[model samples]
Target: MDPLTLGSIVAIVTVGVLFSGISVAAGLLVVSGGFLIVFEGFSALSLMPEIFFGKLNNFALLSIPMFIIMGAAIASTRAGADLYEALERWLTRVPGGLVVSNLGACALFSAMSGSSPATCAAIGKMGIPEMRKRGYPDAVAAGSIAAGGTLGILIPPSVTMIVYGIATETSIGRLFLAGVVPGLMLVGLFMLWSLYSTWKSGDANVLRATTYSWRERFEILPRVIPFIAIILGVLYAMYGGIATPSETAAVGALLCLVIAMVIYKLWSPTKIWEVLRDSTKESVMILFIIGAAGVFSYMLSSLFITQSIAEWIGSLDVNRWVLMAMVNLFLLVAGFFLPPVAVILMAAPILLPIIITAGFDPIWFAVVLTINMEIGLISPPVGLNLYVINGIAPDIKLKTILVGSLPYVACMVVAIILLCLFPGLALWLPDMVMGPEL
Candidate 1:
């Protein structure tokens, strides 16, 4: 069979298997193995183990587990609640401040955790119920939290970015730096839509009767500020030439544990064990996906599917913007079914060369791709964040959650456009601090 025809079959079969409810790692391995045996012969199967092991051998991947530990530690504590409360106290006077604060909390927690579901669970647990109690619509209450949670992958210390960096052999530090401005831009976009939504619905007036004394507002800082400081410290360590991404993650993980212990008194052996266990489980899952993705990539290359596709794309007479639009559409669909990590692992390698050849900055495209994954977290069929919000408020219909998240989806698309129009939104910080990539 021709490579193009075989590639289409593989793509369709892969999607079918994923939607069939098998795990992503299993799906990728099964599809890759099956295709290789059927097409490349049994001898090609021998390299599977070697290929998988080689993918996981990278030193940069060390950051993933450490960052997961940091997220798990903070998620296990009251940090989410404290962060939300602190923001609420300060923003209470602002219209739609309650929901706005949830978006802020999601962005901040995302910076700390770098996991969307964790961000949603952490903040949605408190934010959703509070918004509903304050008379916000179920859609707005559930949707805002769901959409905001996606910031996890776009913010610094992001696990998705790490996977992308490792897969494409890009600098993880530069990828992290590139994410900062785009992350902030998405946060601002979410916030602006939040403010407008609340005003239009008159939900802004909902908080009019709620007020906090300055002391009350300031009181929550001790609990929240430490985490924010840790986030800042991690960013500084990465951008300041003080440490590699892996080293910064390790130190940041330790600080997260220490502070969670000191402030939240989360020092019990069971609690500590839980943190480690969760971290291990998440880390192993992500690593397995990376390994499977490696075999998948190898299979495609051996079959000439990857090269054929890249050559076809490069041969296009369309403008770079058109190529970007095509890439973005593909990513958005891929994200709807696969987790961000899996998507990055499988797609980044195939797309990176094409992106660079087209004269776009890889760092900038990384930010754009991360934002596309953000939309998928709240989208349907495989919308992990939406389900997390559902878990937080089971009473809210999934439809309502989906409805509420729609605006934020639009916000993300807008952010992507803004980035495309001004690539500097993602490139400026990284270039300024790290000196532009040669």
Candidate 2:
């Protein structure tokens, strides 16, 4: 069989197996892409040794596990609960204050953890109960957590950005820097949307309105300061050239561990073991996907699919903005069906070349892509965040979560448009911190 035909078969089968609820890693290695690569008239076993072994040896990939460990450590310690309490106290005086604070806390936690489910699990556990007790509707509570969880990718120390940087050979630290403004923008938009919803629905009184003395407000700072310190310290070290991205991640992990031990005092031996075990499991799952994706990507490249697709896109006479909008539309539709990680692994390689050819900055594209993926997490049917939040609060209908997420999704669309119209919103920090590319 022709290599193109074999490649197409592998791609289809792999995607089918995944969509059929089988493990993509297992599908890639055992039944689809890898198997095809091995048997497709190359030296059978030896020709694709690099696919089997070399791809998994990426040193930068080590950061995935370390970051996961760091996130799990902080999560298991319930540090996020404390952060939420502090934020609630500070924001409770405002309309829809609890929901806004939930968004804020999720964004902050996202900066440290870089995993959406972790953000949801950590914040949902506390945020849901608090909102519930405060008389917020289940849909509102679930929707807020689900939407806020999407911040995990847009914020810094994001695992998604790390994967993007590694895939595209872009600097992870620069990508991290690039995400800061846009991430905050998304948080602000979510907060505003929350406020608007509260106003329209007359739900402003759900949270107990309490005014704190300046001194009392200051006291809550002690609980929040550690998170701020960790975020600032990691960014400062990376921006100041004191540490590499991987090293910064390691330091962040260690700092989180120490904070859990000393300040939170929730780190027991059994708890530590649980964190390690869970992190390892999640890390292994991600790494396996990464390795398999590398293999599948190699197969696609070998078949000239990426090049052909890029050339086809380049030949189009459409306006660049139109083409770009089409790409966003495609991703938004795809997000409804595909997991964010899987979408990134498959689509980034294809779309990235077209983006570069159109003279778009890869860093800006990364942020845009991140936001689009976030949209997918709230889109119906397979929205991961909705399911996660629903798991935490099962009584809420999925339709309710879906409907509640629509306004936030509009906010994301607006954010994407703003970044598109002003690429500097995403690129400025990276260029300033990383220096303009020579």
Top TM-score model? 1
| Consecutive 10-residue window with the lowest summed lDDT within model 2 | 39-48
Residues 191-220 of candidate 1: C-alpha lDDT, one tens digit per residue: 999888778877433656487998998888
Q: Lowest-lDDT window of 10 residues in candidate 1? A: 201-210
Model 1 clashing residue pairs (backbone): none
Per-residue accuracy of model 2 over 309-400 as CA lDDT, tens digit each: 67778999999999999999888877887777767877788888899888898889999988999999988768899988888888878898
The residue ranges of model 2 lying beyond 4 angstroms of the native Cα positions read 1-11, 30-39, 42-45, 211-216
Taking every candidate in turn, the Cα RMSD to the unseen true structure, in Å, is 1.2, 2.3
- Model 1 stretches astray by more than 4 angstroms: 203-207
Name the lDDT value of residue 263 in candidate 1: 96
Candidate 2: residue 301 lDDT (0-100): 69
Cα error of candidate 2 at position 35, Å: 7.3
